[model samples]
Target: MDEWVERALARFPNVPALFGWLGLDRRGHWLIQGERISHARIVETIARNYGVDDHGRWFFQNGPQRGYIALEYTPLIASVQADDTLMAHTGRAIESVSALYLDEDSTAVLDTPDGAALVQGADLAWVLDRLRADDSDKEIDDQALSNALAVPSGTQTDLTLVVGNDRLPVYRCDRADIPATLGFVQAPEPRDGENSN
Candidate 1:
């Protein structure tokens, strides 16, 4: 959080948190009232203040007020950089990927230090290029990928994602189970007895 935002929080601790007004799309674009936020400065500021509450709900600390963000999928959206490094939507560099998951739609989800992130559609090719066979140096072929996707959800695929010097196991996860598996809430609602607007 910025210094001024911290000060504001201390000064007004009772400000009610806002909801349904802010959202994060799968492509990493921030939206307000379902409209994209194009202002660079505002977008950057929101990203800087973004965080998660104890309840697993992600939000942006807007000075004294909290603006909860409705996630389209995972809290973070990761993209592969030109140097093959991973970067999150919040502009944080992904140091390493601890786990990899593939949903029924074949979208890739990466568990990193920052959080579980869904790979951007544009970077799917990059992820495919790094896929390797289970416990082997050989890469997975087209048939291998097809077979992996054919397995039932919640099953471990015989595939691994090679990122940097780390090799992470790949699991088949259903889209409905993503939030619980990743430990995040996609659409956060107000808790019992809490105020929301």
Candidate 2:
């Protein structure tokens, strides 16, 4: 949240919160009225102010008014920057790089920060770049990578991939338990038929 935006809330305390009008799509793009917001400045501004309420709803604080967002997937969306660094959409360093799972859309869901969030497909190479198995950190091979993706069914089994200086776990999450496993709401509906926008 921005400081100037906080002051605006105090100045005009009666502004109502908008519901289901704003949205954050899978690729970390902002959407308004079912269309992607084209202006970079406006999109960045809203992303900067994005936050979750007590009821587990994500919203953008537009000056004093709260514009609730309907999320197509998880709240956090990110990609690997040009420098090969993984970053969260909120512009934070994705820390602890714990676990990875492939979603139904074939997108990577990284378990870090707030619950699990989608990782851009192109950035996935970095996650797979240094992966190694067996008793040692041997250089990645074609067969090993293939075996990693096809883990035995009904198990927590996954391959250990090197992330930064640490070996992180990666696997394919079952489609049915995605929401339960990741601990995030895939689709959020407006509460109590409310529309503050």
Model 1 lDDT on a 0 to 1 scale: 0.90
Find the candidate with the highest lDDT and give its number: 1
Cα lDDT computed for each candidate against the true fold: 0.90, 0.72
Q: Mind giving the per-residue lDDT tens digits that candidate 1 earns over 1-197? A: 88899999999998888988999999999999999999999999998999999988999999999999999999999998999888999998988888889999999999877788999999999889889987777778899999989999888899988877778889999999988987999888889887666
Clashing pairs in 1: none
Which regions in candidate 2 have their CA more than 4 angstroms from the true location?
Answer: 11-14, 104-106, 139-155, 191-197
What is the Cα-based lDDT of residue 79 in candidate 1?
92
Candidate 2 minimal-lDDT segment of 10 residues: 149-158
Alpha-carbon TM-score of each model against the true structure: 0.96, 0.79
Worst 10 residues of 1 by lDDT: 188-197
Name the lDDT value of residue 93 in candidate 2: 69
